[model samples]
Target: MKHLLALIFCVYFSGCLMGQQQAEWGNWKNWGDQEDGTYLNPIIPSDYSDIDCIQVGEDYYAISSTFQFSPGMTLLHSKDLVNWEICSNIIDDLTQISESLNWTRMDRYGRGVWAGTLRHHNGRFYLFFGTPDEGYFMTSAAHPEGPWKPLTPLLAEAGWDDCTAMWDDNGKAYFVGTHFADGYKTYLFKMAEDGKSIDRKSAVLIHSGSGREASKLIKVNGWYYLIFSEHKPGVGRYVMAKRSRKLAGSYKEERQLALPSCEAMEPNQGGIIPGKDNNWYFLTHHGTGDWSGRIVSLLPVTWVDGWPIPGEVLPQNIGAMKWSGKMPFKYTEKLSIKRSDDFDDERLAPQWQWNYQPRKEYFSLTERPGWLRLKAYRPLEADKLLKAGNTLTQRTFRKQDNDVVIKIDISNMKDGQKNGLCHFSSQHSAIGIVKEESACYLEYRKNDNITRGIPIRSQYVWLRTQWGLDSKSHYYYSLDGDNFLSFGEPYQLVWGNYRGDRIGIYCFSDKREDGFVDVDYCHYK
Candidate 1:
């Protein structure tokens, strides 16, 4: 097994070295390709973890776990698996699931909608996810980019996570999920024809092991294959599979399909999708991550004696694998997540996500014609950005370096209101304009410590934050859009709650709820 893995890695990387050079590395938007058909690992440079992918005809849709960001699930679309774009979202508001998300006293953090499965079944798209605290929930849409229906709680019981749904050959439907409450056992339960509810009495213990979850049932060549990931002592977490002629019990032997590479220690938890040519490929995430969070990668899967071994299994380089491969399909065009916003559109871009279920009445794009108008509303309880409701944000892309700038018109601001641009996560830093009873001042906030009274003479200010690959963040402000000046100290951007940091635009008041700010534009480069 190890030799086969090494051979595969050497063959692919050898091909990659022939055309790609070192100087071309570190560009996030163009990370995957040599521009000559070969591609690299971590096709995506940012944290797009816990992905579930499905191929519908010529198009592919992948959804990722978004912990507390409103519009719970991130939907991505791709023509060739190497390039992807943020296309749509699964849920509009998470308050539909639990009011605890909206409670300023409590923040879900890294505990909201988690690892989910996306499947195209019977003319509709079904997406299912489970929260460790809130049990299982499912939502469907006739179209992937959709006006999706409200969420339906499949089971009110907690402790179940990483679920997948399947329909067998006999027209019988089954739901497979893992129970964390009972020593991490994978269970299979019968489901109604409509796939809305599970029959608990028909549940059977199919697999039991440590760190075993993300169970997916696939039928190929007259066999029911149970694919899952498990963690065993020194081996770390690896993908495994078991097969049977029947759905109930008495499944066959298990096979270790794939292991971590030296560069990617935990390349676990993703889906298998076949290409247009009928070749199989595995889309998984590199688990050991920096402050930028887990990044997703695509690996080729070859069947040896009916077992799918993804990429190479290199024992000598236990933490390394082939970093590039020939494109599974012909290249169409390069694509990536959207970062810049002109605020000229009638609807918010798919890239924008609220910190939580936003107070719908506090923001508007049409109010100022070409600007995003955010009304300042006092927090229900907490004063921090993590718990502050209705802050619009998006993930910070992990690369060599990046800059974010936003122009805010604070002429509409009232006394005691603060509006600013922030880099937010469990720990956050912000540079913004704060209005006091007598005057306005520029403030820098980090670690709950404030350095205020840096007097700025204008109501219109451009706030900027630049984050580097080293995880250092620098702040600046400009009265004129071009002449920017540095401020305070350099802040360290960090990650928490199973999420990377986010660039956020926020508006809120300490005394009243009627202040407002008009953001003319936000640019990312």
Candidate 2:
């Protein structure tokens, strides 16, 4: 009640945007220099950032950052944290997050899965996430790899992100997450017993004291432990643990949690579960600079008299932990990758899908012919509202910083046939090209200097985009197959009504007669 009144007072006095009342994503931070990948940049797979995990039986189920892509929750089941694969998305049923493909901060385009909570209790598995821009949502299933239920948006205090769940022994349930709508101030709260809502009656803890507060609650040895993160990126000060006899107060904080010794410190939103061996461990996602290609990192947790301690930090290495593909006789194991999609395949790889309602007739392909044909007839804007879709992108947040280059050839094009590459956040500012009557036109200038549609002479042109952190992105069109030309401005990707980052391919037709872009093949190099 007081918080609500305070929020109302702040809104009236601050002239801030109507929201959770905190400062968020737009904060200026320069993180483009971590390009060398030489120094221990622990955040390698920046694709799935801000992770929450749980151990179910012998398997470990984890979820992470989704700046709003379809199938919002990327669910992975692993035997060993080393080798991971997509089992199912916890949000397969929610058309809003899926069809809307709501992203993070419009600047964080095409990113959908963020700080998801995955757990299994009494034969049922539940997955929860903070659509920071849209409150909280969750789903459940009989198994980790399952036909997850539709996304259920829960009651969340305004101005919050990274909401996670917990169950206390006294038959009480709780959810925790923080928001910074007010400049940089962060606050924490508890969820209701039903788990579908944030308990307004519960006490609130404004995070003004010791640690980075994307916190997790765990009960061990009859005492409750609060394991948390301090916001430093790759360098240490990342993880910490606190405990209290009661749920709301009487808590003590640990001085230092992890000691990786890097230049960053963004150990955020975490989860813990007892393995089959009864050994407890910490599961977290490490931030790769300011770029949100979040990666999954595991730490075996140690506890002392109910207080949780993060385990030893592993040396940083990229895809270096090569465990056997599928091992037996284990506490946690990895599943085979279900992400390999061959455009030649008749159907879209179960894992690869469009953001919203896909006009299936617009696409065609033959396994024997080895090419995917998309007739470009509809104007890209008509198919996509003031939002973004009509493009093929992937959940690349936890995958880390790497240039993705797509190569495809067009057999022919009509004056209305517009097809090219897209790095989208919203409809306002996006970059791509349209081949009209054999001449290539870029979607630029109108989008301001952010993304300009430049026209160049050529029957065949190679369109490329270099998307990176610090909003560092560039578009290039090469008329001469050998060299490339940089377009007018470098797009600093920004999210729209919501927050997200998207990298994909788009084709549209505004004419009554439909036409399309027949992509011979595409390669991510």
Tell me, by lDDT, which candidate is best: 1
State the TM-score for model 1. Answer: 0.91
Estimated TM-score for each candidate: 0.91, 0.65
lDDT of 1: 0.78
Question: What RMSD does each model have against the real structure?
Answer: 4.3, 10.2
In candidate 2, residue 76 scores what lDDT?
68
Expressed as tens digits, the lDDT of each residue in 138-178 for candidate 1 is 88889999978788888888888889887777778888889
The most accurate candidate by TM-score is 1
- lDDT by residue (tens digit), candidate 2, 1-525: 322332333334234322321242222232211223211223224355566666665566677554545545667667644445677655553345544442211222433445656656667887767654466677778877677766667754345555556776675666666654543233344665545666555646635433355666666666676666654322333455666666654565443444432322234446776654556655565543333344444555555434455544223110111111211124332244443244777755545545544455666776225656665645334434223335566643423243544445554556655566665545333455555565656664224243436665554556666654345667666665457777756766544423345566666655544654555444443
| Superposition TM-score, candidate 2 onto the true structure | 0.65
Model 1 residue 192 CA deviation in Å: 1.6
Which whole-number lDDT from 0 to 100 does residue 99 have in model 1? Answer: 75
